[model samples]
Target: MPSVNPPRGMRDLLPADKARRERVLATIRERYRAHGFDEIETPVMEDYVRLHAGIGGDNEKLSFSVLKRGLDAEAIAAAADDPARLADLGLRYDLTVPLARFYASHRAELPTVFRSIQIAPVWRAERPQKGRYRQFVQCDIDIIGDPSARAEAELLAATLDAVDALGLEGAVVRINDRRLLDWMLGHFGFSADERPGVLITIDKLDKIGVDGVVAELRERGVTPTAVDAFDAFLHRPQTLELRAFGEGSIRKALPEDAPDDVVADLVALGDAVGRARGIPAPYFTLPVQFDPFLVRGMGYYTGTIFELAHPSVDYSLGGGGRYDGMIGRFLGQDVPAVGFSIGFERIVDLLDAEADAAAEAIVLVHDRDLPPADLVSLKAALVAQGTRVRLEQRTKNLKALLERAAADGYTSFATVTAGQTAADLEVKPLS
Candidate 1:
């Protein structure tokens, strides 16, 4: 016999560990439901074409393709050289894309402005790290068909409520609008063609510092004068505040033909999220502030994008924003959508949860010589008294069994022998 191990990046959660994780998920799910979001579940696998669509950003490369099964030798040889012909489906890398596909395929059954709650595992083929895994859970709530900034506000409010329920301290949500980046780049002399590529590079600011960004920009053929000017404005102390959001470089960079209401939209959103932090709940003090440097990597983000982070953790706890156009690609008509996903795996990793000691109590049937009916009666009795009980197989090594069961969280054990009444049974404390 060989040892059995889970695949890389996948993990087996023991009973205790699984219970703790489930508790965290349950809290969020309940909160989402209270906000009137309906729960949803999608398949683990999706059409390869949908999975490979360009909206997922770098996640496209991380999808695990499913091979064509049951092919004859001649057919396999004919298609083996072309990836498109080799695989028809792939494991979903995230829930958002699948949600879009679901809405597209089932629009008639859903309300116009659908508020949905989905908590499920998504797969990605990547190198596993301390907290990041190839397969992990994502807890998402989204609103579709409401194209107002109010949609963004509600999503932020509900998300903060869920986060408050999580009770994690010192977490902040840093936000920026995609339009904000576009306006900034247009001011810095980047051509419309060059802006996307430039923003993609700029998205690495947290990973690679200013110097690295400048070098990468230069490598991408952006002129020194433009880079220097952009760097000077971006690095200044006052940039963080963006002061009245219309001052200094941001003011000067504003294109003459720019939409006049962009500033107003920013102000409205800021006030809304600021008020979100003030909502009544435990740990509601977690901050949500504007960050001009935030460039969420997802190409599908058409408007505001925000990243949640703990002051102590280096990686983001997950983020999302308005992808008003994503679902339209599937349905052939545009719909408004905004969402925020809590990194369920990372949250479970960072938080501590205790096991339920009462649930671990057991009934150890130490004597096979005892009638099976007596064992059942004892277990039923214990359960009737609101006690969880597992009957252990008889073993001569009572001390060893007790030690093992105690270590495994059994607090106490009751033993029965042949011809012994319930009163004659010996009840022993295991822990």
Candidate 2:
């Protein structure tokens, strides 16, 4: 007989894992709702063109394409041979893309400066690893149509609040603007075309050290002086300070008539949000800075771009930014937008570690000894009382069941003992 197992990059979320994920998700949803964001749903599969629009560089490579098996064989074959054609339809790589398509298609139906929360699984074709998977959930919140810095500031505040509400410790939101990065590169002599490669290399700065970034830049044909100048700018103390545009030389170099106006607007917005919400104050300590080198590689971002990072982890928990131009790519008219995504798998990994340290468990006792009605009642009671319960099947022995549950990371267990009745059940916490 073949062993039953989930597909690679996916898993059977045991009860305890489900409980933790639910808890985190509930907290996030609650936070989003409290802030007046409506809930919206989009199809899991989208026309490849819509999904791939405005998504280029590294993210484009990770998209998972889908096709009809029999009905469109010829079309599928043609699409498979051409990247652009393949993107005419595919499973959504992230919620943001679908949301952009949604806004553009249904702008009349949505409110101006519409706020929405979308929590769903997004597909990717990347190789799986620790805390990284090809299929995973993403929690996203976005505001469309409002260009005020207040929206940006409020989103940052809400993100921090949501993470803290999940009871996770040491999560930090690192923010920078794409305009700042663009300005920095230009200031250091990187041409407009060179900016993309430089952005990709610099985005990895935290992963790879300064020398590694410099080396990669050199390999990409950037001058030695440009790399050194860029490095010095990023490391300066002013980079951490929320100085007004007039106070900085880099700020002066920014386009006099940039439409997004990230420098003055986003920084002030971050400051206002910081003053209003003290909880995320430390996380949003400095106003959104202009880090000319903070180029987020996604082609759609037209304004601010920020990332949430776990203080101890090298990878981002998730990130997003304003993409006023994304909707226009699909609808042929500009639609203002900003949003952020939470990396569900990374968050689950962090929560799992915390759960392990706390030694939380749910034990399932064999049901053979108890009458079926009694077992059902007991299970209902435990669940109703906010306890995660597992009911063991009759075929499993007590010792085997307990061992298996323990290995699966359950810190507590509730079993239906032979002598206990449904009306008078005794629930004990496992040591």
Could you estimate the TM-score for every candidate?
0.84, 0.80
The true-versus-predicted C-alpha distance at residue 337 of model 2, in Å, is: 0.6
Top candidate by lDDT: 1
Lowest lDDT block of 10, candidate 2: 241-250
Query: Model 1, 191: alpha-carbon shift in Å?
Result: 1.4
Best by TM-score: 1
Q: What is the C-alpha lDDT of each candidate?
A: 0.79, 0.71
lDDT (10s digit) by residue, model 2, range 198-277 = 88888787678777888898888876788778766555553344444222433444434433455567547655766756
How many residue pairs clash (N, CA or C atoms closer than 3 angstroms) in each of the candidate models, in the order given?
A: 0, 19
Q: For candidate 2, what is the TM-score?
A: 0.80
